[model samples]
Target: MERKYFDCLIQAIDLINDGIHIVDRSGKIVYYNAAAKRLDEIDVDKAIGRHILEVYPSLTFDTSTLIKVLNTGNPIFNIEQNFINYKGDKISTINSTLPIIYNNKIVGAMEVSRNITEVRVLSEKIINLQRELYETNNTSVEKIKKPKAHYTFIDIIGQSKEMLKLKTLGLKAAMSDSPVMVCGNTGTGKELFVQSIHNSSNRKNKPFIAQNCAALPSNLLESILFGSVKGSFTGAENRPGLFELANNGTLFLDEINSMPLELQAKLLRVLQDGRIRRVGSSNTIDVDVRIISAINIDLNEVIESKQLRQDLFYRLNVITLIIPDLSKRKEDISILIDYFIKKYNDKCKKFFNGVSKEVLDIFMDYSWPGNVRELEHAIESAISLYDGDIIREEHLPFQFKNFHPTKNFTLDTNVIQPLNTAVEKVEKEIITSALEQTDYNISKAAKIINVPRQTLQYKIKKLDIPFK
Candidate 1:
C-alpha cells in the first residue's frame, strides 16, 4: 500500500469500535488504533513503539494469541481472554489473531478483539432468572416459604349479579383439575380471576406461574412455553419453560388468542397428552400442570380470524368462564369505588368521604372501555388530586365528562296526550333511549340513567320496554 493510502487505511481502522493491534514477528508493537488504546486503558505515547511483553507484562507467549500466531504462522479465532489493562483495570474480550505472511514467510501478526464484559454480565443475569425459575419448580424449600401468593378468591371484590355468578363458577372450576378458559374484555380483571382460581385450587401449594402470551414474539413465546436446550438458536442456553416450571401447579397463559396459530396446535397436543417437548429436544416430559388460559376476544371470532386453532380451542374450552365486562356489571361500581377509595386512602394517608353524587353519576354514565383497571386508575387519580371531603365532578377524569349521558327528550309534534300519560310516555322514551344506546346491556343502561342495574331491570320489566 502507498504511504498516504496506508495512513487513510489506518484512519479508517481507527474509526472501528473494536480493539485492533498489530505487531512485528518478534512482538514489538507496530500499529494500535484508538479503540485498542481505549479498551486497554493504555497511554498511546508509551505504547506506540513498546514491545508487546513490556506493555502487557501479564501476557506470556503461552497466554498471548498474537505471540502464538507469530510463532506458528497460523490464524486463531474467537478465543475469549481476560487480563489487566494498562491501568490495571480488568478487561475481557473475544479475540481473533492472524499471522501476516509475505513471500511465504511470517512478517507480522494482527489482532482484533471485542469487549464482552457487559454481554457476559447480561448472560449471567438471564442464567440467574432461569435458575430461580427452575429452583422454584424442582427443589422444595422447607424453611424459606415460596414467594407469597399474590391473590386469592377473597381478593376478588364484586357484588353485581353477573359478577357473583362468575365468582361462583370460578370457585367451582378451582376445585377441579380440568383446563379452564377465561374469556373477558381487556381490563375486566381476567388475570385477577385466574390468579384467584390458582390460589383456590387443589394445587395451591405448588407453583403458580402467569405469562401474557402477547408479550413476546412467536418464536420467543414457543421457547418460553416449552423449555429450550443449548444450541436451539444462536445464543440459547438450556432452560425449562413455564410448562415444566408449573408442573403439579397452575400455568395461566393470558391473551392466548395472541399466540401464533402454529404454536396453538402444539399447545393442543400438550393439552391432549399432558406431555411437552422442549424446543431442541426430542424427549417428551410429562407435566401435571393445570392450564388456565385467557383471551380478551371471543373464541369464535378468534377461530374465524385464524388467530386460534379450532382443535386447540375445544381442548382449552373445557371449563369456559366468560367474565362480563364492567359495563355489563354496573351494579358493582359503587362497591368497587368504595373499595378503591379505602385502598387509596390507606395508601396516600388521606381520609376523604366517598365520591359526590355528581361524580358517581358521571362515573355511572361513562362507558369504561378499559374496564375495572381504568376505573381503579380514575379513582386513584381523583383521590390523589382531591383534598376535599368528597371526589367531585372536577376530580373525575376528562373522559367521564365526554361520556356523560344527555337528558334531552324530543317529543313528536303530531302526538298529543293527557298530562299524566305524556309524563309516563316521556319516561318510557328516556328508558328506551338509555337501553338502546347501551346495546340493551342493562348494567350500562342503569349507569347511563344514574340508576342501579336492578332498578333499570325492574323499570324495563314494568314499562314493557321493547329491548333485546
Candidate 2:
C-alpha cells in the first residue's frame, strides 16, 4: 500500500506543468520528472542517480539553489535563476526549493521550477524595439516631437467647492518638481488630473509616460521600469526603462499600491537621488523625471495591510491631492450630466437636450460607485438606445430602474415639499426596491445599491422597512 501511494504521488508530480527535481543530502539526483527533463533538455536516464553538478555542468555548489537548500536545510522561494544546461543552452526559470526532513533530520531537497525563458526573451525584444523606435524618431527629426499630454486644467469639469479646491491644489503641485500622489476612487479621472499636472509643469515639452503598476507581474514590471542590460538574464538585450524614456518629463505610475515591496525599495532609492541602475548592471544613470503616482483606495488602509511601503509612500506623498467621490460632491451631478449629454450628442450625432425630471431625480439619488465615468457611460448608453429629444427613465441604464421614484411623491415641478421629507421619501423607495430585488438579502441589497451593508441596515431601521 505504501509503494502504491508513492507511485500515485510520483505520477501526479510528473503530470504537472512545472519541473520537479529531487536531490538527496549528498547531492545525487534521485527524481527528475518529465517536466524537468523537457525544461533542462536532458535525458531522464542520464540525469537520475547522477550528481547535480554532473548533470548541469554550469551550476556550482554556491550558485545552485537546490544544493544550497540541501546544505543549509532552508527553503528559497520564487527566485529567478538563469543557468546553462548540459546541452549548452541558456535557461531561465522561477524556482522554489524546499528541504525534505524525516524524523527531525534533513534527508533531501526538492526544487519546483516554472520555465520563463520565452517570456523573458519576448519582453526584452519588445523593450529593444521600443528603444530603437524612440532613438530613430528623435534622430530622424530636427525638431524632436515628444509624447504630448492632451489634457490641461481647463479640461477638468467641475464647479463644486471640493473640486475647485482640488484643482487649485493640483495647479500648485504642478509648479513644484516634488513627487505628487493623487488619491481617488476608481473612475474619478485620476489620469485626467495626472495629465493636467504634466501639461502645466515646467517639463511639459518632454515625454509624458504612464504605466499601471498592476498591469504586469513583478519581474516584467521591474524590467520595464528599470530596463535591462545585454546578458543580464538569458536572452536579455540592452533596453531603457520608463524612467529613462520619461527622463526630462513625467512618469505617471497609476495604482502605485500594487507595486511589489522590493520594487518599491528600488523606487525609493531613485526618488531619493534621481539615480537608477538598470537590471543586472552596476552602473548608475541619473534621471531628471518627476513621478506622479495615484492610488484608488484609502492611504492608511493599504499601509496597514503592508500592500504599500510607508517609507516609499512618504517619499511619493510629498504633494498629496485627494479627489472627492461623486457622492460627496452631489452638487456637480447636474453639471456633469449636461456636459456628458452635449459631448455624446456631438459624438453620436443625436440631439439629446437633457434628461427628463424623473431621470434627473433618479440620477441624483443613485449612488454612482463608478463615479463620473459611470455617469458618462450611462448617458451615452441612453442616447444610443433612444433617439428622443430628451432622455427619460426608460432610456437610462437598467441600474437606474431600481431607483425609480415612488408614486406617493410627484416629480412635477409644480409640486413642492420640504427638502428633508422629499429626500427621505426617495431614499425609502430606492432602498425598498433594492431589498426586494435582492430577496431581502441585506448584503446583496447593499451591493446592488452600492452602499455599505451597515449603512443599509441603518436605513432599514430608520425607514421602518420590513425584511425576512
Candidate 3:
C-alpha cells in the first residue's frame, strides 16, 4: 500500500466508534486505534507492540478471541467477552475477530470490539432497583394491596367481530395455566391482552412481569431472564432474574422472535420442566410461573427464516391468539375514536363533542399501519392542537392530510350491487389500501391486513389487482 493511503486507512480506522485491535501472527499487538485506547483505558503508546496477554492479563491464549483467530486462521463474529483489564476495571465487549490472510497465509489478526460494559451495568442496576422495589412493596401491607396488572378484559375497547372473538379466547386462555402466544403487528395492544390474561388468571395477585427481548443483547437478556450468580463472569453478582421474581405469577416476554436461538432453547427447557437454573449456577430451582409470550410478525415466516426456533414455537404456542390490524376491523374505528376522544377530553379538560364527519371519513379510509396505538396518538395529537368543540381535518396529523383513498368501490345509488359483489369490492379496497401503504410489498401488505401471505396473493390474483 502507498504511504498516503496507508496513513489514510490508519486515520479512518481510528475514527471508527468500535475499538480496533490488530495483532501480528506472533500474538504481539501491532496497532491499537483511539477507540481501543478509550475502551481499554490505556495509552496508545503503552498498548502498541505489547503482547495481547500483557495488556489484558485476564485473557489467556485459549480464551483470547484475537489469539484464537490467529492460531486457527478463522473468524469469530459477535462473541461476548468479559475480562478485567490491566487497570483492574472489569469490562464487557462484543467482539468480531478475523484473521488477516494474504496469499492464502495468515499474516495477522484484527478484532473489532464494541464496549457494552456500561449497558450491562445499567441493566443490572435496573434489575436490582426492581428487586428492591418488589421487596419493599411486598413487605408493606398497604403497598401489597396494589395490583400487578392494571388492565383487564373490560379495559379492551374494541367491539369488532375479530376483537370480540379474541377477547372470548383470551378469557378462556386465562382460565387455563397453559402457555399462550399473542401475535400481532406493532402497537396492536399485545401487552393489553397479556395483562388482561394475567389479571383474569389464578396468578393475578402474583407479580406480572413483562420484558422486551429485543431491548437487550443475548448475554444480558439471558442474565435478566435466568438470574446470575457471583463469579459466573467478570463483575457478575448473585441476583434473581424475572423467572424468580415472577414466581407463582405470569412472565410476559414480548418480541420473543428477537431472542437468540440459544437463549430460546434455555427458555424452552424451563417451559418443559418447571425448573430454572440461574446463570452460572448448576443447581436447579423449581418455580411455578406462567409464560405468556408475544411476537409482532408471522410465526411461520420467522421459523422459516430461523429467527425463531420451531420447537420453542410449538412449546409456547399451545394457545395462539392473533390480534387483528385496525384496518381489517374498521367497524371498531368509530368506537375507538369515541373512546379516545372521551379519554383526551378528561385528560385535556376540554368538552370536545367529537371529530367532524370529514375527519372521520378520512380516518375510516386511511390504513393504520401502527394499529390501535397509532389511532390513539393521532387523536391525542389532534385534541392537544385543537381548542374547538369538534376535531377538524386541519387539526389532524400531516399523514392524514397527505393520505389519498385508493379504493375501487364507489357510492352509486343508481347502480345497486349484490351483497357478495359489495363484499368482494370492499375486500379488494382494503387489500389495495394496505398494499399502497406498504409500497406494493405483498408480504408486508398481508401483515398490515392481518391475512396470510398466500391468501393475500390468491386474492390479488383473483381480484386481478396489480402488485409488485
Candidate 4:
C-alpha cells in the first residue's frame, strides 16, 4: 500500500472506539491501532519490531489456537478472556481475528475487538435477576411481598395434633385464592402460616413479599404498601412498593391489627381495586397480589371498636385461621426439638444427635409465650453450648436452665409477667439465639428482631446481653 493510503487507513483505524491489533505471520506486531496501543500504552511507531506477547505480557494466552488459525489460513471469532492493560485496569473483550491472506498464504492476523466489560456487566445483572427469581423459590424463607416473616410452612417444625390441624388449614389456604387472616399471639408464628399459604399457592412462581403494617409510620407504611413516584417527596428515589412488586404473587401483612385506620382504608381499597397508584402520582398500576395477613391483636375487638375498619375486616376475613399457642401444641414439642437439633448441628458445627429426654420433658411442659419461634431459638442455643450429639439440660440457655415447667403452668399467672422482666427474657432469648445462629452480629440480630438500630441498642442495654 502507498504511504498516502496507509495514512488514510490509519486515520480510519483511529476513528474506531474498540482496540485493534494486527500481527504478521511471523508473530510480530505489524499494525496496532491507536485504541489498541492506548490499552497497553505502546507506541505503534516504536512497536513494529516486537512480538505480540513480548510487548504485552497480559495478552499472552493459548497460542496454539492462534498458530492453528494462521497455519490453516482461516479466521477465528470471539476469543474471550479478562485483560489487564498497562494501567492495570481489568477489561473483558471478544476478539474477532481474520487472517489477511495474500496469494492463498496467511500473511497476518488482523484482530478486531469490542470491550465486553459492559456486556459482561449486563450479563451478570441478568444472571442476578435470574438467581433472584430462582433463589427466592429455593430459600427456606417464605415467599412474600413484604419483610414480615422469614419462615414458611416447612420451616415450622412440629408434629402435634394442633400443629397438624394448623398445617392442614395452611395447605388448604395455600390452594385457595381468597384472602387469609392468621391470628396468633405475638411471636406465635402467624407469619409462618402466611408464608406457607404463599409458597403453596398457584402464584408461587412469582415473588412473595411481606411487611409489618404497624411497624412503619402511617405515611411511610402507605408509601411502602403502595408506592411513591420520583420527586414525590424530598430525597425520594421513586421506588415501587410491595403492591406493585408483589404483582402476580402474595403479600403478607403482619401485625395487621396495628395498621392505622387511614392505611387500613387504603389497604381495603387495594384489596377491592387490585390497583395501586404511586404515593404522589395519579397513574394507577394494576396488580394481582394475594393477601395473607397476620395479627397479634384480636381482630374482632379491632373491628368492633373501629380501631380497624369493619368493612376491611370483613373483606380480609374471607378465610380466617386462628393459630394455637405453643402451650396448646405440646404434642409437637419432641419433633420440633429434634428438628432444631438437626438444624443447628450443621449451623453450629456441633454433633448433636438429639435432645435428651430430660430436655424434651422440660420443653413439653414449658408454656411457650413466644411459641415456635421461641423454641427454635432455645434449641439453637442448646446446640451452641452442647458439645456432644445429645443435647442435655445443661446446654440450654440460663433462662431455660432455671425454667421450671410448673413455674407458670396457669395462663392467668403466665400472662401477667412484668413487662420489663418479660422484655428482658425475650431479649436474652433472642440475642443468645441470634448469636448462636449468626455467630453474633448485632446488626443481624437487630434485623432478625426487626427492631430499629437505636431500639436494639436500648434492648441490649436493658437486657445486659453482651454482644460479642
> Candidate 3 — which residues are off by over 4 angstroms?
86-88, 135-145, 406-468
For lDDT, candidate 2 versus 3, the one ahead is 3
Tell me the whole-model lDDT of each prediction, alpha carbons only. 0.80, 0.85, 0.87, 0.71
Question: For residues 5-91, what per-residue lDDT tens digits would candidate 1 score against the true structure?
Answer: 999988899999999999997899988889988887787787877888888876777878788899988898766665666566656
Tens-digit lDDT track of model 4 for 158-224: 7777777888888998888999989888767776678777777787767777676663346556666
Candidate 4 structure lDDT: 0.71
Worst 10 residues of 3 by lDDT: 136-145
Better of 1 and 3 by TM-score: 3
All models, RMSD in angstroms: 13.6, 5.5, 4.7, 20.0
Tell me how candidate 3 scores on lDDT.
Answer: 0.87
- Per-candidate total of colliding backbone pairs: 0, 0, 0, 13
- Name the runs in model 4 displaced over 4 angstroms: 1-154, 405-468
Comparing 3 with 4 on TM-score, the higher-scoring candidate is 3
Query: Across residues 279-375, which tens digit of lDDT does each residue of candidate 3 receive?
Result: 8999999999999999999878878888888899899899999999898899999999999999999999887888888888878877788889999
Candidate 2: the clashing residue pairs are none
